[model samples]
Target chain A: MNIDMIRASAARAEGHVRRTPLLNSHFLDEIAGRRVWIKPECLQHTGSFKFRGAWSALSSLNPEARAKGVIAYSSGNHAQGVALASKMHGAPAVIIMPKDSPRLKIANTRAYGAEVVLYDRAGESREEIGAKLAEERGLTLIKPYDEPQVIAGQGTTGLEIAQQAAEAGIENADVIVCCGGGGLTSGIALALEAEAPSFRVRPAEPEGFDDAARSLAQGKIVGNARPLGSICDAIVTPQPGDLTYPIMQRLAGPGLVVSDDEALQAMAQAFNRLKLVAEPGGAVALAAALFRGDEIEGDDVIVTISGGNVDAEMFERALQTRG
Target chain B: MNIDMIRASAARAEGHVRRTPLLNSHFLDEIAGRRVWIKPECLQHTGSFKFRGAWSALSSLNPEARAKGVIAYSSGNHAQGVALASKMHGAPAVIIMPKDSPRLKIANTRAYGAEVVLYDRAGESREEIGAKLAEERGLTLIKPYDEPQVIAGQGTTGLEIAQQAAEAGIENADVIVCCGGGGLTSGIALALEAEAPSFRVRPAEPEGFDDAARSLAQGKIVGNARPLGSICDAIVTPQPGDLTYPIMQRLAGPGLVVSDDEALQAMAQAFNRLKLVAEPGGAVALAAALFRGDEIEGDDVIVTISGGNVDAEMFERALQTRG
Candidate 1:
């Protein structure tokens, strides 16, 4: 991938995406024997880093394309991101979400003025409905991943982290990103590889959904027969994306896995000590770093916290389980 | 009274106190019919703005005084603040907390390396025990409020807000702060009154604990005979401090009250929209602006979020009630 092209894409989406603070964690520093910094995409507009990619893809469109509108297929962060970004650009958005998706996410997406089309994931594929709707309505289909512009947009987070970490006198650190389709991890890894070569990019995923980790080990893309039974519902993809797989293969430093219990404990730690309401998926990288200790090195480590849109009831249940 | 003196105290405590962000709120702007910003002291080291005052007090001490240690009397934020501040300053801290205080607070204070000194608030005065201990152990008693250095320290938050608002191109805005003993409100008012004369400072207290508002109106400090039944446990003080009352009388713009339900609703709103885990006390000023919309008249408004040390169960319940 061309670094300058990625940087240009990042510049285009700069104002649209929040320059979220890279927060320092005193508690994580003590436990991990490393200086830990969190890139809080959880604080981003629409509560996720998916906004970066969504805005990048939508904004790259010409006037005619934008006028035709955009369509996305996801029940999670990407849906909200695309909806909000399209709304910001005055372009209509149609999000095909699973009917069983969390009410909070659905409400949030619709609140951003996106036309939500609920479909049963068990009965029908969201892709089929989303593609059909896009074709029928003359709308642009914005893929959640597997797009160059989207990858370039996600790269901006890494760019910001590298800049901020350098300013903080953190010369080299492990940048841990939670992986599903590998958009976030691949983008971040490519950016870090080009800008801060000293910084290692580690992809962290839940145990059951370890496709990225397994793929990295096998030097090829891998697929899982069953989805992850982890609380990190956002990164439960069974396979990595075609575009992101090769990038991850080249740029990823290491891949790590953490259990559901570890992720829950890490989420609670973030809530109590850091005062950050990170979702289970968002807490996975930090969870892996803290739980799978020897996998990471150096005194300084940066974890890309992907989102903060966990269901309130689910958060309560997680807290109760902690007790 | 001396602005330079306050600035010096702030500078002395800069490293110890968190330079909390003045966050922009899109949700608040849409709901309140104005651009809203939040100074999130809730994410401070001890989960409250009290940490700034306590840290300032401890840091300003002479070498001899530092060696002797510090003591404080409180069942909430103040206790935790003093404990954490003293620990940061490498001084022994003894917190005289009410015996009936929540187990969580006791655990927090102890976690910060303070010696927990429980006193029977029903039978004996906590102040008496604190004073006795201070005298016997040669430890300086750090009052929660009513201290010049502490007030000056709290004033730093206002200073930063003024600077941040200016940077954000907000020339004039109404700054609302939650009032307890008027420490935070008075300090913030004084800072804004001096540095940003165009800006106005308002005191927002929970409905039942409207002593600050009552006293402001009557031009004399008045105590609430009955305990407030608000969920904002941190700001349920019965009276304003002597030092804070006079400062507030001279500098405070206005006084307002918000209901417990409003505070809880605001907390839920902050969690969902801003991804902030603010406790009830922290959300009061925002709640005042949100619930009592008719009284406010400004294009820009800044609300001070005081703390985020809410119990997980309490937070869960609040979410369920207002989610």
Candidate 2:
């Protein structure tokens, strides 16, 4: 969780991943009641910021372990991230996914040349399956957000934000991020604290799965009541990771939460105003920015849209849904 | 249309308009069956490249004319562009719009503080109305694409493409643009011919409204038999503009056309892969690059997504329809 570690990871990812642009819109500025800058990681490889972490983890592995390959468990973004990362490194990968996950996610993970193992989300533990597969196949396990290397890798996004904002003459602003396992939030928090100390990362989450918000407020780890039914499937984690909480607790601000309807509205706004396709989970931070504008300080605000791997029917439903 | 005029327009538009980013994706390259670079003017001010031309035209007005205000006619994008540009210059504006234009476009145009006058697309000539209003009110007329300053302003998009592509190590590309009065196409053609001599601009149009394509092939201005009924309403011009034609006829490559369904497919693919919101007309060039891969020359191609001001229902239909 140091600046040097994050800088090293960014260097490794420079030529490997897409250097996504930082977007700005006067339309978005009016919506959030401030100068708004959007960092659309929805354009990232694998359509999410997860690929950065995946690549970091893969790069940190020993040659022997890399030769043996890796195993990862994720319902969507992380699975595709690891799959693509492994392919880039010429390593085989096994992705443990939920049987009920979106068909598009599953198909994409496989298309990236990963072996897919489907397990019932409610009846089976993906952790158990991943551990067994790793042990049996002599493969390394790449945790989605808990690993130090992965966190450092994800921190590159914060570095980009700092550089881009400075280039655009933004002195400082609150950087809001969509929170899932708190990995992205914590990573950005650490990076911004080191690179742009005046800024803070505010975690954004769905109403029912606001564990990160509760955890930050209470100054401890908190778990969700239920995570199965949230339409923001990409960010419905059970709780924040142990490794990630300390960074978030120290460097992050009060977390923000928006209802599913609000997220839908944000997605539509992103599509219409920013012309960026953001999934529900991806739109949560934007929803918080637009809905919770009063809590935000300064005239400029930066929000990162984290993913866009939405199903066709679900996106249509979101388009039809009103806040 | 000369280099100096485009450079002057770029200078005037430096701070007043957005310098849109050039977007690239390996996923899009795979779809086009070649190296693909996207210059997304969809993220431009007012959500389209029209604002560039509008700002250029408004900036070129004499101080007296600027104070006297301006009048323009457009189906949608140009109306918003003019309204915003006029507001920026403290020039009052009157926009003559068709009654059948999207409600969102009309509302946005008015929101920019312009007076709107609706007329029938079938029975009324917007040009005549605009001229009459200009004559009566002592307001300067801003023809959408026939004006030299407007074309120079639109050519900024081409200048940006050339600079960004060169930075990305692309020496030359066949640049495809969504065509409407041949303004965008001709503007880019002039810029690329001067700045990136090896490259050429290619106009993209809807299935039936391939006026620019016909004009290029015939070496004369060719009008569409009927232009009112196309899904790509933003780019359904009756014929190439008088001033814009010769530039397109000389500097543009053989033009490209796509059906409504193919444009929808391109829109869907843009959302799914590129994570950009592209209206039907804006998606035509990408559609041509995707569906007509064999017809396109070289392994590298550049496509401009001209706008993203689609209505919600239209976007929903695009996401749902499969070619």
Candidate 3:
């Protein structure tokens, strides 16, 4: 939660991760009655903010662990991020993904030069398989959200936003970030709380996966009432992680939920007007800002577009939904 | 053209025009046997490089001219650019478009606060009608191309690329730009010919509208032998303009052409791999790099994506073509 540690992590991971631009959202601004700014992590290498955490975590590994390579279990952005980051560090990576994971994500991870091992979500426990692989291979397991270095690495995005907003002459802007396991929201909240104390950090959750919001209200982690169902595949985790829940509780301003239709509409608007191909998960923050504008408080709002790994079919459908 | 004047125009239009990003093309680079960089002007304001030209042209107008408003004739990107730019400058704009122009473009221009005046391309002369309207309304006519200020504005893109390349440690990258009325190529050539003299500036022309290529070789402006036919609607100009042709004669390197299929494939690839929504014309340079790799000389080749204002139906069809 220290700003200095987060800054150091940012400096350490400089060339490894891209400083994705904070672009102005003209259409969103007009619709929401506020000046909208987008932090396009969708443009980040590996097509998500996960790379920041993966690189930070991997880079902090000891020589012995590094020599043994790394293993991760993720069906989406985190998989690609680990694959690419591990390759950059000259360590082999093996990603365990659900058999039903999108072919695009699988292809992208393979393209990044990683070995993809698919398992049935219904029949197998990915964590167990990942741990078994790590144990047998004498490799390190880089958890997507739980690790301290990973959280700190993700915090750098908030640090960059604070710096970028200041440079853009924005003194205090509300930040709406999509939440799933809460790694990104927690990291961003921690960073903002330390540096830009006046800035409000809100967690935008998909309708069924409102654990973070529930947890915040109860002052503890909360499990989903039912399995998640949404086109926003990336942020459908069952619950927030132990490491991220406390941080979200401490700094998260308010939690909001957006429907699948809202996410799709936001995705279409982003593609047409901003010319940015945001995945459904990436567009959730924007969806909340546009569809639930009354819940937000501020003239200047910054939303995090967390990834851009959507396939053609999905994009076409999203656009159709908008029409 | 004076390099200082171009530089000054670049400085004047700096904040008004976006400094579009130069994207890495991993798939094209592998296929082309070299590194490929894509300058994504498709992501520019109003979804085209025309924004640069329009903003530059409109901003340079005298107070009296500004008060009188402006008129432009274009079927695609130019119309949208002029509409948006004129609105930004507080000058009313009237756009003369073919009655059959894509409904999306017509709607976009209207949404940008421009008056849409449709004409039948087969019957009435658009220029004559546009000029008459300008004369009657006391509005200034803003030609889409064949104008110094418009060329200077487009030159700002080249200036940005040259500066960006230098910063990336690329001293002599090959730059491939799509050519229509030759305004973009001429302006880019003028900028690179002076700023990055060692770099080769190649013009990518659609197979049907090779007027710029033919004109360059014959040492004069040349008309297409047949009517232009290409999916790349934005660059289907039948002839090169007098102003742009001479500039192309003085500054352009060899011009290259690609088939309709090739352009479609490039557009699909841009959407799939780069997560960029590029219109057909915007993808022509990429198509050239993918299909005509042997003709290009350097290990580093930069392709300019001219615009991203395609009809949604057409985009869906193009994506389906890949299937």
User: Quick one: best lDDT, which candidate?
Assistant: 2
Deviation (Å) of A160 in candidate 2 = 2.4
Q: What DockQ results do all the predictions give, each relative to the true complex? A: 0.63, 0.65, 0.57
Q: Is the docking of candidate 3 incorrect, acceptable, medium or high quality?
A: medium
TM-score of each: 0.92, 0.93, 0.94
Docking class of 2: medium
lDDT of 2 at B253: 64
Residue range B4-88, candidate 2, lDDT tens digits: 8998999999867877767676567877789988788887877889999999999999999999999988758898899999999
**Segments in model 2 whose C-alpha atoms lie over 4 Å from true places:** A59-68, A120-125, A132-138, B25-27, B62-64, B119-125, B135-138
Best by TM-score: 3
Clashing pairs in 2: none
lDDT of 3 by residue, B13-47 (tens): 76577788767745567777888888889778888
Which of candidates 2 and 3 reaches a greater lDDT? 2
Every prediction's TM-score for the first chain?
0.96, 0.96, 0.95
Interface RMSD of each: 1.5, 1.6, 1.5
TM-score of chain B of each: 0.97, 0.96, 0.95
Q: Write the per-residue lDDT of candidate 1 for residues A212-240, one digit (tens) a residue.
A: 99999999888986875768888879788
Give the per-residue lDDT digits (tens) of candidate 3, residues A101-155.
Answer: 8787788788887899999999999888888998899988888887888888889
